[model samples]
Target: MTETYDIILRNGRVMDPETGLDRVCDVAISAHKIARVGHFEGSAAREIDATGLIVAPGFLDLHAHGQSVAADRMQAFDGVTTTLELEVGALPVAGWYERQATLPRALNYGTAAAWIFARKVAFGAIELDADVHPIDQMGAGSEDMCWSTEAADSQQTDEIVSLVRQGLDEGAIGIGLPNGYAPGAGVKEMADICDLAFQYGTPTFTHIAYLSNIDPKSSVDSYVRLIGLAGATGAHMHICHLNSTSLMDIERVVELVSKAQEQNLPITTEAYPYGTGATVVSAGFFMEPDFVRRTGSNYSNIELIRNHHRFTGREDMRRAREASPTDLVMWHFLDVDANDEHRRLLDLSVTYPGGSIASDAMPWINEDGSIYEGLEWPLPDQLSAHPRSSGTFTRFLREHVRERRTMSLMDALAKCTILPGKVIESCAPQIAKKVRLQEGCDADIVVFDLETVTDRAEFNAMNRPSEGVRQLLVNGQFVIVDGELETGAAPGQPIRREMP
Candidate 1:
């Protein structure tokens, strides 16, 4: 007698970080959940011959900023099944979620309530644009600049808190605090935000308040304040992109996070694999006169992503910053040396045993500041932007796991999948049912050839898709099959923290 399943993956090397299961096996799925994870006499409506492939939970990105169709396709080719804008989250969380729900995407999606946008709205800095993503709308013009440099008054603080609560009530996963971009947000304001997270039983995803490796208030000082807030309010805190933020001081920053965890503080951190970091020219870090000295990068090392024009001098940098404050600029912090410190630092973040990996992906905007729309797969050659947006996870597996052997494949897989799932599950319990290959888990899975997996996207030619991702599924629906995308599949569902 044979049982039936919606789909059966036969003879694949199944890997589950949660249960330490790593062996060649068969997995059966029914409806949209895993039904069995071992050999079984079963017939299926659809069967995948996943022989010689690594069958693991689909990858989840916690810091993706490109929340559009074009971005989704790029991520799908790289094997990402779910992506969330947790670093610089959306404003008016309901509107963001509603708009996304109406669209067809290649992967599951969600976002946090953006604290920076709330402050912008309260201060009347800039009117929120319905069409643009919240992070793109920020720091674009003179009015938006105030959201970063001007401190909020008491009334404004209250308004910000109210907006955050409204977002939570509307099912936001957590609170996104990109404090580094908004230097004017005072300690009280930040603490109040964390307090709100504590009150609502959610986490706060933060880009630390400072990025300087050294100064009056360095990354160390920033971690102290953030960790202190978590200790005081009992709010879970997630630090974003530690590699770029910590620079030469990554070891110290990691130590601080370790001590906090030792004291049982609910704190976690993530980092991208790249050495160079990108951000808007108008960010507060560029406002400082000694910014170059502090970050150890000069004008020559900075290049505009739109035109690939390198900044020649102080005046050129100033002119560019003033001319287009919102344009993306790349900082070559890791180019100073080649002794593998940058690689080592990145390895430390993924190998920390408690930290997760995030891409901090930026969108591929055209020269006229527009993103491509529609359900086209393998985006056209015209799309160009940060390589990390397309290749972070693939590069991590290729360079760290396969090439360097710094971490086992199973360990690295956990960093990208189950670890981030656990972090989100802390705030949204629904996520606990996702991001694993066990029975009763959501059938979001990836099948890939281990030996040939690698990233092809580079800074010069940025939008290239990866190689060796054979298939990808979201909620048991195939988004990519036989190394090609299944166009027009909108099976991606919203992962939210519905209020109890």
Candidate 2:
């Protein structure tokens, strides 16, 4: 007789991008693995009637930055089961992983070894603080500014490479290069990091060196350089947030990436669904005088995330940049007309073949400039954050797949799940089993009402959780049940790359 399973999801429209399975089926779970994927005669301790719901592999976010309990709760509500800080990764990778392991999390977590943080350590710009990750201390007035502004010499570069090696040895998923944040990092330094990734058979997740469309070093130039490095070193290169980085030039950027893939150089890119991009006002991105011309926007296009105040002129920008450099600001670059070229450009990135979807999520900060931590979730109304932190995946389903019909449901799910899974599995073997609904796979799943699933979080009220995600399971345990979050469930495990 078939043994009774721990849990069973019955009569759901199961979607598996990998096997191309989309049909009504019963998924049985026992312990942490999916036990079956068809009709089940045995009874279960718990059973969910999932009729008219879509059950797919939980969403995976490769560019998440909010690595806290509050952030995880928000992500779980959005149907994400795994989130990584691959863009601006962590420093002292081992410590970061250890610290997170001690906390209760609602979703799986991991990070790449951060080249920016490693460089800061080598330059003696940031001291190793066991209690705090270097990224937590980054502010305009902090010592991190030196690493972002000052070019590294040969000795310093070698030390940075050594630190990255140590992190890789400590089980980092890959290497993170936020070159745009560190403008002083030269081409040689960037190439060396790629070489390190190649040596370990891991990918380099990068926020490219330039964001502007204007020359001398345009966004196109940056992609060409990275593609060249990938071709030269055989390193898998994953570009972050193509829509924000490429702006209106995403078409040409996608063309270049496609061409590189055609030549068999392993390269991938991801984009969030929103039209606006968020970042700190004090970063090097806003320091250039040509920022207006390059981004095709002026002072009015910049709005403070904290207070929603628009930067009226150069003085307003200067005051914000100087007084509160770490404050979040939104750049309304893609918020154009519906039929405008900008919207088309944004759509192209989202619908690009095999391109993964990632949320470059920011953390929710309180009125006292503190981040919400340790199960203090459902952030207060006064706290501010980018909506992408809570809504990227849901928004993609609603706008692109449902409303515009730009992307089919299967293709969209593939982008959010299998595509990202393959990208990370190339480096982290631990995640190879995730992002697919199959027998013997980890039972990370999401059940939602397709007709009603949508993101409700807007810029001002960014903490509002997404609606219609009826249930979310991490490692076969429900973190969200019936549209409500289960605060005590901490079934999330760490995703790490095993050293060869």
Candidate 3:
């Protein structure tokens, strides 16, 4: 007699991105393992009639900030089971783990060290009052993001580097180079850390330094430079938010990067599916006159609807400028009509090589225990811009891949799943395994109502629950069942991707 399985999903279209095969079949799971894959006729204690739903490996978000609970919440609706926080390695690893250990999320998590964050935390001695980057004994600062000054020039950088490696070594899937936001950080700082990331074979996701600075050293130039670094170091460089910065030039930039890749440069990129891009008011776009005018968005033209930290309204934004001139803010940038350069950009990458989807949503908790609020300042448009938090995956699926037919669904899912999974596994061997589903993989899976799903959590969409997550399971426990959140469960697990 065949042993009864724990759960069986019968009569569903199995959309396997891994196999690129779509079929009407039954899928069975027992002991947290994907028990059977083909016309599986097995009895189970619990059975779901997936007649028209799509059963694929839960989607993987290549880029995320790790703040919004909805980040996990949307997983149910978006078919995402594994989500990675590639946010410039902001939080300390141990503390990050400590907090995540308690958050009520419905998924698996992995992270790399934020070299820039560590640099700033360690930058206590650097006098921000001065403009010239603090010169070190080595002089040129960390060459090629190759290294950073000790200030003491001692073992501090070594320590940070070790931590960076340790995070990956400890199971972080990849490295984050929030390089764009940290101009003071030199190339050496990047190169040194990336050397280790390369050594581990983990991909380094970078925010090209020229992202917001679309002048002098424009975003395109920064991307070219990052591509060059990827080629020189033999490091895998994954550019984040390909649509954000001067990303309107993405087509040409993609061609350039692809050309580099023809010569075998380790470069790839991803974008969040939203017209408006967000960043701190202090971001390079704000500093540049052209970017501000082109986007037709300025500090005064924008409102501070959300202040997760000390920054508040326009007055607060102004004061915060005085307070932490380097502090970050999220802003919107997109146009309904393509400018001339944008047309050229599109022509270059009519196929738009290697751009994936990601949400750079940071955890929005304040000292007073609050998530970020939209800007309150009376600006031209009080509209806040962050559709990625809820709708990135769906919009991309529904709009471009499904509606506009920009790319096939298989190509789209590859960006979310196999790509990052393969990238992370390079360093974190545990991720590159057959056991991930062989009854022993950490149970981070999301089951969704593919037929009816919605992601309408815009800043103004009063009282919205995420759309269409039928059943979400993490660590063998259901977090969302019958399209509702299971408020009383500790199914969330922090997937540390390093070695013991």
Candidate 4:
């Protein structure tokens, strides 16, 4: 293996859940796959002498917003290898692919077939952008979601479906439903595309509406509806940030889901480990008067991020509220706690006996950089973005498993590795054990300087990169080395499904 191996990472605690091996070993890599994973005497072109460190399969970000070059840079340093961006903002799949030609990336790219946002752009209507019905529990909060665009004729619907089909062809793993908007999709459109996904054998990722801190109805209903959609269409459906919706009732939610699964709902989920949910405040609770009933405050108290108005005084707040009903406002709502009423939301996710974590991260920039205008003055992002952005893995190792002694290290790591890998493989078969590391897998691996590893981003101290993800390899290319991004090693490509 050494003779033909191109690179070898020697002497490290390798944790590969798929292989069920956790011990000190040397990993030999050749031709973009793991050549051997045992004691090695390798003479390779490049060698990382990983003595006393973690040599694990590289982590994949299930959903990321690495749209800009800078955001991609941050993700590499943060320990993300292959990322699928579902925030299908303004660009269609084809245009997004073309734009990637302009940036040098450190990981494999995948997309979501964006129905909601794309329709918003296709039709000049705002209501269609918000998927919530006017009578929904979260209807008042619909201002933040992409509403349904004006009703498209059958021809228009066909064209939109064609665009989504194009996205699937271009390597979009599946459909993305910001279901809070797009109620017009109802059961009909959902069945159509879900059937398409089932035919394609892909997944549909959902951020369901009425799935929030304050739904009088059971959030379990949202899960049931999604399960029904999956049952009807036969598409695998993934719920984003499931723990958030589960709130303090992990047992209840988990029990319901398990029962639904027993009934064959084809539903599954992933969550960020942090206690607090991260979203533009206005999007989730602010604009919703009903949410005001749930969260206890309206737009007046919601923290603003990148408010261009300077949102100087009380007058600015009143005027801006008058101007844009749907301005983007990022808010960090929950404080650190173990057993506060809503605080249990934080508890259930990380401590859940069997749950996976992800960083529901957005690109972090200065108040001016990321925010759209008049939206809301942004929060000073010491750690305003979700903690999972940088802290998900580390929090598990340091705080939960290692420090508190709640979970064993193996279980903690399993949540990070094999569980997510299985889910992604099931969701994105094209990239499956192929582009990522699984056997005949692309040698996308990460060798950690576990001794010094730490997540530096705090609620107020964001923009600080994680320390000691010493070496990162994406498809056998060295993107991070010795501690930082290696200059000029951008070999990532835009993955496509099969064009519509």
Candidate 5:
């Protein structure tokens, strides 16, 4: 009798980004790994007929912030197999990991050492709370902006570095430097963190310190600082959310990064296929007096997600921020749908050579201004969140690969899979088994129809999930089948580095 695999995905157009393989084939899964990939005459307890579907390695999201069961469900529709919190990660990394281990999850998850949270703790501003996610900490410094705008004294800097090192030692995949949130962090502080990362031979996921189109501490200056740190410390510097941060000056900044890459500096970039971005309304940069002028956006561009309220002036925005500093707001940096120039600027970042695609997805919140952490299926339609949380990956495939045809499907898949996996594999060895469809690799895969796959969630109706994922498997367990989510499935596993 032939050996029967656990599950078999047969007769699908199997596309492996790493091998450039795009042909009809069968993929066998057993023991949470790919057992075989070819015309294998194998029997399986469950077989998914994937005719006319694209079978590929599930996407790796290196910047996801939505870390709950609700967020995982939405991301599953977007074809994400692994979602990591690497931009602004968790503090007390061990506690964070411990907390996650106890919860049932749908997709694989991991976090980096959070620099912002370390500074908050070192500065004696807030207590470490494993339940309060890093996203909630964004505006927690609103009372004085101390964590966001105060330079750490030598003693405090030392303490901060020590905290970050502890997180890494506790198996954080990398370091999350949300420098933009704490612009007050001097060059020396950044260098110290980068040096620690170098010692560990890990990457520093960074949101550069500034975000303006012009000089005198502009986005260009920030990129220069990040690149300098990588060159000086010999650490990998991963730039997060390149599109929204660069705004209209993407061409100039991309040029600078390109030149740095040419010189072989350790740098990588990621961008979501959107013109707008979402963050706390009271973020550090929004408080700048020249914020509207620098970003070429006004108060009207910032809309509170809970109620769709747009501020009319600085005072209006300030009042809202002061009332509820942690409220999520949509910042429309570019009118991509209305302006051709804005669309092109966005394309520059999204389609950059060798760049990866990341969602930077936010968490789900109820209309009453509380986080929706309930384990509910078919998430409440009244819940609010950035559309990108549910649509990012599919949107990229729809616009770039199917609609525009600006790039081939294989290259696009690389952005979603292999490129992201390569970004952190140097530090997180477990990722080596992911992002591939060949034998011996982890069976983290997705099947979808190219023609019908599209993002249904928009700004007006943000709760709708994307529509293309036919089947999704994480660790060889089906979380989604026949375009439906398996509500009871809890197959997620932690993707962390081994502790010493």
Candidate 6:
């Protein structure tokens, strides 16, 4: 009897990072699971001639923030199937999940419990609204920067913990402690957060507390504090954006992290390929008097995306931030193209053994500097965002594997797929069935021509999606086929931590 499949990918270089299986084979999908791998004489309702293409598990982004239909479509072209908001996650987890359930999504989405947002609610600084992402409302508390700069008293700390616990109880994937966003959060509070993560058997995703290259609250100092917390609480601590946060002092910072991992302290890290990072212009660190000295970059490196305006100096940057504190800005921490040293610094983080490749992708915005919430296809021409949002996975493949050969095809795929999946699978067991090309895994796959797979999105034209994805499937449904987006398909599912 011939087995039947819903879809069949024939004669593709099927690569599974988990089992190191890289060879020409057929992949059969049926009922949202990979039905078979190897020779398939079976007929399918839809058949894709995948000759000369790479068939692998779709990439997983653990630090994604572009959680809209438009954003997901752009990422679909880049071969991503699962995007998790593990860093700076959402408050009121159940409400956020409920809101997302009503939207049409192109890729799987999930979020962690946001410590900072919980703080805002606990301090009576902001109202709870699941529809409002933290990035959109971060500036509302910027009047005094109290949420980022004030220590919570005993009662406030209790309230904050209670709110965060409620989110966890509601099945948030983990705890998100973006310490850099709130540097004044006391060690006691952080320790409490780590303890909760340990109790829940989940990881804590963090952006370290500081970013200065020099001491007295340097990146090194921050790493030490984070390592101590992990050790003291016996919790898994995952560092976000190792490249941008380490600045020029990545060597020292990586060494400290390496030693901690050597001692088996459960410290993990992720890095994006690009040196520039996107964030709110009014970030607390940007307001520091020695911001330029600390980051080793001048005001010109901070570019407002809406008008492409580069600040001439600190005052100019301050003026723009004061006017619209929540506006998105790109911070060019390293010029990888012009400087060999800067490029090497980025490579150190990106190629770090055991580190995953995550896109800390920002949301798209309109000309008015508002987040684009409409379910528009191809995105609006005037919409702007960091190129990393759309191109991180494809760009990594083109440069690291195909072009420079800095990483092997199999290794790079692991960084994008299995490595990231394993990071969160402990808490979100549903992810265990993803990020594999084996039979019985969820049928989330990407087929692309390796030779031509590259990012089209550049700094100047940030909205362009990547090229050369022949087919993309999420849960046995095609979001993109034959290099064109299926504008009507929305097969995305929620990836949440299982509740008791």
In the order shown, the candidates' Cα RMSDs to the true structure are 1.6, 1.7, 7.1, 5.8, 0.9, 1.0
**Candidate number with greatest lDDT:** 5
lDDT of 2 at 295: 68
Write the residue-wise lDDT of candidate 4 on 390-477 in tens digits. Answer: 5556655666665567776667666665665565565555555533334566777877765566677665565566777889888788
Q: Estimate each model's TM-score.
A: 0.97, 0.96, 0.80, 0.82, 0.99, 0.99
* Alpha carbon RMSD to native, model 5: 0.9
lDDT (Cα, 0-100) at 221 in candidate 1:
86
Name every residue pair that clashes in candidate 1.
none
Preferred candidate (lDDT higher): 1 or 6: 6
Global CA lDDT of candidate 2, please? 0.85
| lDDT per residue as tens, model 5, 1-500 | 68899999989999999998899999999999999998978799999999999999999999999899999999999999999999999988888989888878999999999989899888777788888877787668678778788889999999999999999998898999989989999889999999999889889999989988777889989999899999999889999999998878899999999999999999999999998899998887887889878878888998999999988988888898899988999998999999999999999999999999999999999987667889888899899999999999999999999999989999999999999999999889888788998899999999999998999999999889999899999999999999999998889999886666
- Model 6, span 103-215: residue lDDT tens: 88989999999898888876777888887876786666766778788888889898888888888999899998889989999999999889999998999999999989888
State the lDDT of candidate 2 residue by residue for 1-500, as single tens digits: 86799999999999999999999999999998999998768879999999999999999999888888888999887889999988877768889999999889879999998888788787676665535643354543442477887788899899999988888999998998888888778878877888999999999998888888888778898899889999988889998998888877899999999999999998998998878888777677776778888867787988887788998877778787677766778888887466477788888888888899999988877665456564565677887778988888998999888788886899999998999999989678767677999999999999998899999898768989998899999999999999999989998899998776
Kindly provide the TM-score of model 4 when superposed on the true structure, using C-alpha atoms.
0.82
Candidate 2 residues lying further than 4 Å off, grouped into runs, are 133-135, 140-146, 336-339
Measured on C-alpha atoms, candidate 5 has an lDDT of: 0.92
Count of backbone clashes, every candidate in sequence: 0, 0, 46, 42, 0, 0
Task: Point out where model 5 deviates above 4 Å.
Answer: none
TM-score of 3: 0.80
lDDT of 3 at 416: 60
Return the number of clashes found in candidate 3.
46
Better of 2 and 6 by lDDT: 6
lDDT of 1 by residue, 100-165 (tens): 987787788999988888888887876655567764666555434677777788999999999888
The whole-model lDDT of each prediction reads 0.83, 0.85, 0.56, 0.60, 0.92, 0.90
